[model samples]
Target: MSLGYFSYPMPVNEPVLQYAPGSVEKAALKKTLAELKKKQTEVPMYIGGKAIKTGKKVRMHPPHEIEHTLGFYHEGEEKHVKQAIDAALKARQSWAALPWEDRAHIFLKAADLIATKYRTYMNGTTMLGQSKNAYQAEIDSACEIIDFLRFNVHFLSEIYKQQPISSPGMHNRTEWRPLEGFVLAVTPFNFTAIGGNLPTSAAMCGNVVVWKPAHTQVYSAQMFMRILKEAGLPDGVINLIYVDGPVLGKVCFSHPDFAGVHFTGSTGVFNQMWKTIGENIANYKSYPRIVGETGGKDFVMVHKSADADVVATALARGAFEFQGQKCSAASRAYLPSNIAEEVKARLVAQVQSMKMGTVEDFSNFINAVIDERSFDKISSYIDNAKKDKKAKILVGGNYNKTEGYFIEPTVIETKDPKYVTMCEEIFGPVLTLYVYDADKFEETLALVDGTSSYALTGSIIAQDRDAVILATEKLRYAAGNFYINDKPTGAVVGQQPFGGARASGTNDKAGSMLNLFRWLSARTVKETFNPPTGYHYPFLKES
Candidate 1:
């Protein structure tokens, strides 16, 4: 069927647009945003490449400007979940049997489409629907999504080329096959790129997927689905549905054809899904691949020799960007007492200077949180810290939800290392700081490691080489994505394959070959050039 070996070269990461004032990209993005805001879009469930609309519609609103209407999405019931699974299984055979190069091209074309035709649309939808600013939207909805698609294709290609060695007179080869059944991709609301990557990455490996995105992210999700369709993705290859998580899980987890799940959400939800799968283990066709990147109370550790300005800048950006909704966002920090006062002053001044408002204004660095529920949850911690004597508010603890879910970038100075705000994952623009003795750098490293159960992302900021080395060795298992004198966010696709362990995720490394390996099942074949027809050996006859 195939003639020659095909090689897909490694792809470079997409360049992030600056969206500076008077720039063409900024103008285009602004125009797209205006167009998106002017009309109300009617979205539907994509089942088997057909738009299935139930009358049960949920209103979509911008988190920053909740007073205005964006659009509505038709919500589905439990039966639709069943339909999605059936549709995925029906299309699995043809999709898996298609040539790997064909699959690669489909995603590659999708990447190009995002990079060219639909770049502003992608960023615009994310900016409005998710309350992300122009720059944040560009890096996430445009660049990161494009990077994931291209990098994943290249990574999967490399995976296909890996084979086994052979002995004399024989040959050996390996066939990398997709799983027997369909994959379930459960994506989150925080990152538009994650929403795109989870489903496409699995589907790129020749696996059919039943994708369910966060309700808040459906706007951008639908945009991405349309792009995939235009890129020539086959019917039922990836079925996008809108249903409650429990209802969807009820059907898929118990089904015999449920092969795996590509998930990015909370740890509690992941644990529940794993437990349910374990309960129904005998009902499935294979051991389900439960891959997830869940919650994080990510940290930053500063040494005495670290620059105060550098420490301040890292905390300012790493803790507050995207309203601190990123799982990799630095939520906790341990600073030495030597330069802690100076860092605090600079950080406070920076936080005070940030302008908070809607994403329409390019000048505003801070925007609303995702929703009312997230606002309440994050505000409660700040409120609790206010009442406790052990914790003191450093700056920015105000919150209001009359028009939109807006919370100030709050910082709490805590005497206890394991303070509630430090231990718990408050996924908002809130950072907790704890000062340690300047001489106790190693002890402080241990404190940072032992403070939280999460090991998602963390950084050690130090100018002293010995302090860096000691902290690196001491906090080896503290984080999956560790940084030296840098913030623990903004992981590039090809350079830093992202994921974590210790309740963070399976650490399959999404941007690398390791993730593609999860979707594949390998079979080895060995053949001999000659066969022996004699019943006995020459030595036996002589004896």
Candidate 2:
């Protein structure tokens, strides 16, 4: 029995070119995604009603632990970004003027169309570009997008029909409408669902969006835009561009028509965007809105009364799903001293048994990290943990790059709760375990809040009714989705709106009506038929 952890190359199902310099499949994939041909062409930056090819390009690699080039994305320049912004500004007037039902219909049709024709491409792209397993890619890239688009339409309609009160001898009504300008949306590469979220939320509210998608998954974003357009979304209503952060921020911040920004990324980037918005505050034509969902170092707190089997399953999913790359991914666990040994045994057993292989294989529970950069980061963390005298590798922690960026599911047991590994966001298939005495349950909860910087997603496994209630109430701020005897990941749409608090996010919780309100501005429209030919004048005189 090897306790050192296992690593494997991502096996390919079809013929894939060796990640060589100029292979035919490599060229073909790039061409298919980027070049605009007589039939299907490679993708480009959608700006000002046309696809603009860039002088520079970004290369993408297959995530299946296979040696092949995914494709290249057009590295859009400042001009393209500005053009996209201009187009969005121009489109907003007509889009905002459309009746609410018409606006809702566009999103509904777009959602159904994607589920029909484009799901395969979206899922396959995530599997290749994001290094996610088949199930993860399908869930994040295809199903979640469909959920947001469909659910938001219903939510928007309900909000649209809401009306305000009227007073005696007077008529008054209030309505919520789109902001009178364009919205700038910046998305992360971790989930295809986010691509739909940041832009679709505003677009559904009749605000045209100038969207800058993650360069890594630009192909998936392009496919989404095409589907929306085909479903009768007017051109320019949802413009897509690709450019680096600083340059794009300048356009988003300085433009008078840039009414708001919807963002999802790191805390550092969010801070920078917030500062830029501030600097331009005096020059802006309107008070701009900036909404963000940032980083997380999420935690899972467990007690001795918990079911060991349930804890094992929850730990496996929370720490290893998507190779632990999600912002809401749980990176640390706190266990009671009495059951620490039992919990560790079950966790190790489940982690060691997980298959590290291809997405299409269906049985492999884990897959490669998103890229070599992430692989190196996770690998460094494992090495550091090994060097720490207080910590020892319990199950798996190894890396192999025979094909793509692959790392084994890793669990490290730490004696000292104050260790840095227990505090930081490992953002990989790496989990740090800390044990405490059963009598110190409240102490353990405090330790969880102190060590973990995020309150994104977490869980507790306990059978005692009072204990469950106590843990849930105490750790309410520990996560956006706090589960009892269940995995923290795999939050279902419509049932649990997902997002976090504190350093995690704005707690808007995607997939619900609450998030829709963030994208709209309230308007009060009052009409008096000339005071009913001067009838209202009597009330005014009496007052």
Candidate 3:
């Protein structure tokens, strides 16, 4: 386990389980989810290895079943933010001074724990709290999180092993130093994996973190901290808090020791934070690094030569998986008019076969959107599309939230490519499609580019080699993660690093070396072997 001066280890993507009927994974997930559903507990705010409870509380409920209470979290105030930041700063010196190998050992152990010991519990909590089905929960809460930990461990070593090339007379070295102060990780609620990754990656790189996960994700976020603690993460290294966004921002952004922010949320919130940082730039000891991944208006373009079944399957899975909550999910599409009907028929059948209900049901593929707010926003879009003259509800467009925040997988076909649904980021299980004349393939590509400001994820499905090559070259900047004959969703950890350009994000591809670079500052060192050190250079000699 301890062999190497410098070498790159191949990072493996954690294999996803099928969780089929009567399989071990299915049985384990079902058993754990039922146990969690019956238990109502209080989630505490952890700071410096201690759990502090506040009187004010936020009751937690499953997004799919609103009536059922999963748990309650201790709502933190402004005081907690300061305390967390202080806690992180206090732990900074010892954590950063530790050897890189020692730090790598802790995170590698964490990866093993998540992949083996805590897999079922984490997946079950994600399914119940976040409304992800068995398969979805397994891929996100268990597999992806494990991959992040393992790959980051390797990457951390890679960073340390990197040194500047030295000349014959002098030796030069580069040090990747952690920031002088604490890091703040503001994570989203969609993927429990990202929620874990935002904080852990920075902490693994020897930076102390003040992690504030989205309130809706606290149920699993609590479990995430538990696993990290069990895996031997030290006290005060990562101070976990649950405070209001404004309160947290006001304090953290204004603090002198606020070094950086690892954020994955809405563009509006990110932009506001960016402005605040700029306004308070003079207050910080060092320049703060802002790394974020925001909104996406992803698309799927189908050429005439595509396989109808493949195109339909891709749409069904890409647009409807996790209720289309991924930032990379396909929200719009362009199809050739000649084969539109054939593709539509197959797509409708695939959508019709999906079951929308609670995550406990193994047959159910579509679950509820995150909560009431999301449910309302998505329903309004569907309703508005129904009233539009150029739009038609081709297959599914039904919604009921009495029992749970349920919205059926909806498909809106519109004659106008500029329809609101086609351009906007709905972040729901709704797909808007426009069928174009087969000859206007190039023109349609231009429409896709100009349609939305967010350039996140997209796919081009074509059997013809020429069409595939043309689309690849033409729409290079359109998507950060572009697919060929496949769906835009499900970007893997190592193989297909994910992010986008434009309004989508800063395009710092997570799970890659580039993302890690943002958390580091480089310093070059030089030492001369000879004692003839003089300020004058050889070039100063006169002939």
Question: Which candidate gets the maximum lDDT versus the true structure?
Answer: 1
TM agreement with the true structure for every prediction: 0.99, 0.89, 0.97
Better of 2 and 3 by TM-score: 3
- For all candidates in order, the CA lDDT equals 0.93, 0.77, 0.90
Which segments of candidate 1 are over 4 A away from where they belong? 534-543
Q: Which regions of candidate 2 fall more than 4 Å away from where they truly are? A: 1-41, 530-543
Top-scoring candidate (TM-score): 1
lDDT (tens digit, per residue) of candidate 2 on 250-357: 777888777888889888888888888898889787888777888877677787788777777788888899888888776788888888888889999999899987
Pairs with steric clashes in candidate 3: none
| lDDT score at residue 160, model 1, on the 0-100 scale | 84
Rank by lDDT (best first)? 1, 3, 2
TM accuracy, model 1:
0.99
Candidate 3 runs further than 4 Å off: 1-8, 533-543
Instruction: For residues 152-245, write the lDDT of model 3, one tens digit per residue.
Output: 8778778778888988989999989888799999999999999998898888878999999999999999998988888788899998899989
Better of 1 and 2 by lDDT: 1
Summing lDDT over every window of 10 consecutive residues in candidate 2, give the lowest-scoring window.
8-17
